[model samples]
Target: MEGKKKIVIGLLGESGSGKDTVAEYLREKHGAKLMRFADPLKEILHIFFDKISREDQQWLALQLRERFGRDIFPKALKRRIENESGIIVVNGIRFWEDYDFIEGFDPGYVIYVTADQKVRWERSSKRGEKSDDGADFKRFQELEQSETEVHIPEIGEKAGFIIRNEKDLNFLLEETDRIMNEIANK
Candidate 1:
């Protein structure tokens, strides 16, 4: 609300829904700066494990919230956002706190990425960054129920822009371009 002029975008999506991919596309195509809530959590995960998993990430997040407070990440991210300008994309908007902080940006938009559960499961299987990436469908379903992921769909309902990522990369990028173009006209 001060002198800085920034277009903030909050990205909300379930695991494997292509949120990170879209953020990267924005970064490369729109010169958008990216900030993720899980960045700090993932940094901590990297310190302890050779291969980080979604389950562990959820566990760590809950632990931190219990030790500190629910606002820990949101507060830290708010500080980070204040320092950044231009097209800034805040990935992993899971909680109300995340959305509330992002709402302060004058030209902000929430982008929700959605895909069929099966398609997302398939995509998750191919991504080896998480140790449980290749987990079976049953396990994948359980992981989706974790606290960190449970609120995604509800929050996604609040998005002004929605992108379906079930198709090819080109289609996803095309949809992304469409949204960016729409935002530009705003």
Candidate 2:
């Protein structure tokens, strides 16, 4: 689990594209190591805030970025993964700069998970319980625009694997499994 060839995977997609679900599945099936970039904010939250809300976490994350700049997470992650090998799945890679940073570590694969706009919006509404108030499609679009640019089409085109998640979960899982097996053999 620790001292195996480090295969870094980047999951890129817009909100509600089931990135987390796919990442979890890959990790469980392949025994891949996992890292979430936003976790540094959560790690030290108790030192700064009494009750760490998501907004608070986001604010602290912004603060860290302000202090450390765009490469903070990736640089930190590089060190954490220095002695680690095998499949290392990076969850929540937000920026293009972050992508380049991870790419510097090794030749890795990017997987873009996608779904139809309606399905994606519905999933976002259901999953964004702490953040969004059930809103119109235009409003949801604007909100997502305010967040990270998903670069969905570009990322998808560049991805080694593309999983269309608008179908049933079982189908998605099967497609994901096939991709994992292929990547593992590589």
C-alpha lDDT score of every prediction, in listed order: 0.88, 0.73
TM-score of every model versus the real structure: 0.94, 0.80
State the lDDT of candidate 2 residue by residue for 32-66, as single tens digits: 88888767876797676655554455566667877
Clashing residue pairs in candidate 2 (N, C-alpha, C atoms within 3 angstroms): 4-86, 5-86, 6-86
Per-structure clash totals for the candidates? 0, 3
Prediction 1 global C-alpha lDDT: 0.88
Write one digit per residue (lDDT tens) for candidate 1, span 1-186. 223468899999998999999999999988888999889899998998888888998999889887998877888788778888888898998777787777767877999999999999999999887999999999999999988888889888888889988889999999999998998888
Following a full C-alpha superposition, what root-mean-square deviation does model 2 have from the true structure?
A: 3.2
Off by over 4 Å in 2: 1-3, 44-63, 133-136, 150-153
Scored by lDDT, the top model is: 1
